[model samples]
Target: MRETSATRRGVLAAAGGALLAGCSGLDEFGESSDEEIRSSRLPDLTDDGESQPVVVETMPIEIERTVLAERVQRTTDLLATLPMSFGADDVPNGYVRKQLIEAAEDASEYIQDARTAQSRLTAMRSLQRARSEARFAAAGWGFVEDGTTETARQSEHEAVIEDANALRSDHAYLGEDPVEAVLFHAEVEQHLAFVAENRYPSGSVNTDELLTVAEWGEHTEYARARVDDGRYLYDRFRESLPADAGSIEETLTTAGESLVDELQRRRSDLPAEPTEGDHELVWRLRYRVRDAAESSARYAGDEPGAASTVLRGAEGLADFLAYERIRDRIDDGEQFGVEEAADVHDARDQAVESVRTALDESPRAGLARPVLADAAQQIVAADEELARLRGTVRPARLDDPIRRYVTATARARSVPAACQEVLDTLTQ
Candidate 1:
C-alpha cells in the first residue's frame, strides 16, 4: 500500500520538454475557429441506425450572483498579479489571459457586466483545451490493445496522446454552465480526435504525423496570441482562477490527480525513483490514507477482504490512468450510490482532505473553490463507471438503454444554477 516517495514524485513531474515541445507557433492556438470546435461535438449521426442530435445545455440563471457584487473588485487586485507568473516564454501562448487581465483592469469599469461574460467565456475556451483535446488523447489510450506492439512502440498514438497532456486544470471542467460551454468543450475534444484520425499530412503515406496539424492551427494553438502578449490564454486562465474560496483546493486536487495519472502512465519509463515535482506527487501517497480511512469507516468487519477485491479489479484503470491514486479520487465521488461509483468515494474524500492546507496557499486563490474536493470525488466516480463499461470494450454494441444511459449521464453535467445558489446561501 505504501508508494515510495521516489515512485510518488515520478508521477508528478512529467517530461515537460516532450509534452510541451510544439507549443511555439505565434499563431498556433488561434488558427482554429470556435465553430470548428463546436461542430466536432455534433455527433457523427451519419450512422442513422441510432443517432443522437447535438445536445447543448442552457442555464438561464444569472452567474453574476455566484460571488458578491463587491467581490468583483477584490478579483481585480488579484488578476493584476497573475500574468507575471506565466513565464515570458509561455506568456504569448494565447489571448485568454490577455482578455482576462483587460477585464480585471476595467473591474470598476465593467463589474458584473457583459465584459465579465466575454472575458470569462474566452478563458473557458482556453481551459477546454485540456479536457477536449489533451484528455481525448490520454483517454484514447483506452482504444489501444493492452498487450500489443503498439503499447511498446510509442507510435503515432503517443504524439496524439502527449499533445493533449494538459487536461486536468479547472478551465477544462467548469462545473456545468450555459450549453455553449459544454458543447464547445465536447466538440473541441471530438475535433481533436476526428481531425487526427481523418486528416493526412502531405507527402506521407505513413499518415500519422502532423499531416493535418496545420488545419487545426486555427482551432488550436496557431491562431492563438504570443505568450508574452497581453492575450496569453494560459497565464490569464491561471491568474483568474476562480478564487471562490475553495477553488484553489479543487485545482490542487485536480493537479495532484493529473500529476499522478500522468506519471503513472509513464512510470515504467522512469528511473527507479523520481526527483522533481514532489509537491504534486504527494497527493498519490495520500491514497493509502484515504483507503485506510474508508475501511475503518465502512466494512470494518470484512473490510480488508472487500478492499482487496475492489483494488484488484481496478488495477487496469489505475495503471492505464498512470496512478493508483486515481482509484481513490474515483472512489470518493460515489455517484448515484450505484455499485461502481460508491465503491471508490471513501478514499477519494480522504485524499482531498489530505491536500487541503497547502492548496489554499497557492495564488490564483480563485482556484481554491470548494468544488476541488467534490469535483475530484465526482470525476473519479464518473470515470469509474465509464471504466467499468469500458472494460467490457463494448462501445459499438451498447444496448439502446445503455447507450442513452451513458450518453445522457455524460450530458447531464449541468447543475441548475438555482440549486447552487440555494446551497451557497445556506452555506454562507
Candidate 2:
C-alpha cells in the first residue's frame, strides 16, 4: 500500500508518543543525594531458574578515567604556571607564599579525589569541586600590588583583598569543600596583614593607569584560563566513554529524539514560509539542533559507532529542515538557492542510512532482546516512511506539505527514543 502523508504523520506521531513515554527526564548529571545513590538498585540478571548472560560494559569507567586524567592535567598545568612571586621583589612575602602553598595543597587533594573516584558521577562532582578550589587559589595572586606611599600601598592592598573576597564568593560551588574555602579565606586575611607592614618601594610604584590595565589584564587572564580549563575537562569527559559502554548509545539516541521534539515545538511558531525576517529564529533553531546532536553524539564514546551514526542522522535532518524552509521561500519567488532541494534530498538519504546503520549494529541479546526488537521494528517503519518521502519535491499543496513536514519532523524525533529504548531494556 502507498503511504500517504496523512497516514505517515499519524504513524510517526504515534511512534513519537510511545517513545516519549519510555524516556526519562534529562537530569542525570545533578549531584545525586546519598540516599538516592544508596537506594539505587544494580541490574539483576537472574530470571526464573536460569542465569541470563549479561555483559557489564566498561565505557562508564573509561569516561570516569578520562575526566580524572584531564582534571589532573589541567590543575597541574595551572599550578606550574601560577605566579608564586609578584611585585618588584622577586621573592614572595610570607603571606603570598602561604596562599600559594594552600592552593597547592587543595590541588593535590583534588588530584587524589579524581584518582580515587569509583564512579563517573562521583568523578564529575569531584572535578567541579576541584575546579572551584583551583579558581580561588589563582584569584589570590591578583591582589599583589606596588605603590609609592604607605597610604597608597595600604589602599591598593585593601582593594586587592576586597576583589579576592568577591572572587572567592563568585566560586561558591567550590564551597562544597568547606575546608578549602576556609583555608582560602584565612590566606587572604593573612596576606592583607603582611601587605600592611611591607609596602613596595617608591620607584616600583605603578601609576593609576598602569594599575588599571594590570587589574583588567589579571581578571581577563583568569576568566580565559578558567574557560580553557573547563573546555579541556568537558571535552575529555565527553570523549572518554567507550563504544561498548552498556546502554550509552541508547541514552544518546533518546536525547537526540527529545531534542528533535523540542525543535518541532518551536518550529510550530513559525509561518508556513519563513522569510529572511525570521533569520534569527532559523539561526537559533540551527544552533539548538546542532547542540542537541553534539551532546547526543558524546554518548557514542568513540567514533564510527552507533551513537555517532545517530548523531550524523540528527545533524543531517537539521540541515534538511533548514534547507526545506529555504525552499519554501523559493516557492514564493524569493531569491534562494536552487540547489536546496537537492541538498534536502541528500541530507534525508544520509539520515536514513545512519539510522539504519545504528539499528543494524545495536545489540539484541539478553533481557533487552524483545524491547530492542520492538524498537528496531519502529525504526524500520520510520526509515521506510522517510525513504518514501525522499524523492518528493517541495511546495506541492495537493500532497499536504504540512503533513509531510510533520512526518519528517516526527521521524527525527523518534530516532533517539527508539535508540534509548534499547538501552532502557538492557539496563532494566
What TM-score does model 2 achieve against the real structure? 0.23
Best by lDDT: 2
Candidate 1: tens digits of C-alpha lDDT, residues 1-428: 11222332122111100010000111112213322222221122122211211111112222233323323433343344333433335334344323223333333233433233323432222322312222222212222213223232234434443443333122343322222222223333333333344333222232322212211321232112111111232233334434551222233233234333433444344223323333322333233323332332233122112212222112222222222233333347422221222222222223323223213332221221211222233322332333334222222222222222322222112112212322232223
Model 2, span 1-428: residue lDDT tens: 11222342232211111111111112222223322211112111112112211111111113445545666666666556556544446324555445445545665565665565434434443454455445434434433333223344345445644544453333221222221222222222333333333333222233443333333333333333333333343344334434443324344435435545544554444344323344343333333333443443343333222333333333333333434444454456543211223322333333333333433444322212222222323433433333444332332211222222323333343444443443343234
In candidate 2, clashing pairs total: 2
Q: What local lDDT score does residue 313 receive in model 1, on the 0 to 100 scale?
A: 17
User: lDDT of each model, Cα atoms only?
Assistant: 0.27, 0.35
After superposing candidate 1 on the true structure, give the runs of residues whose Cα lies further than 4 Å from its correct spot. 1-124, 127-343, 352-382, 385-428
Clash list (residue pairs), candidate 2: 253-416, 254-416
- Give each model a TM-score: 0.21, 0.23
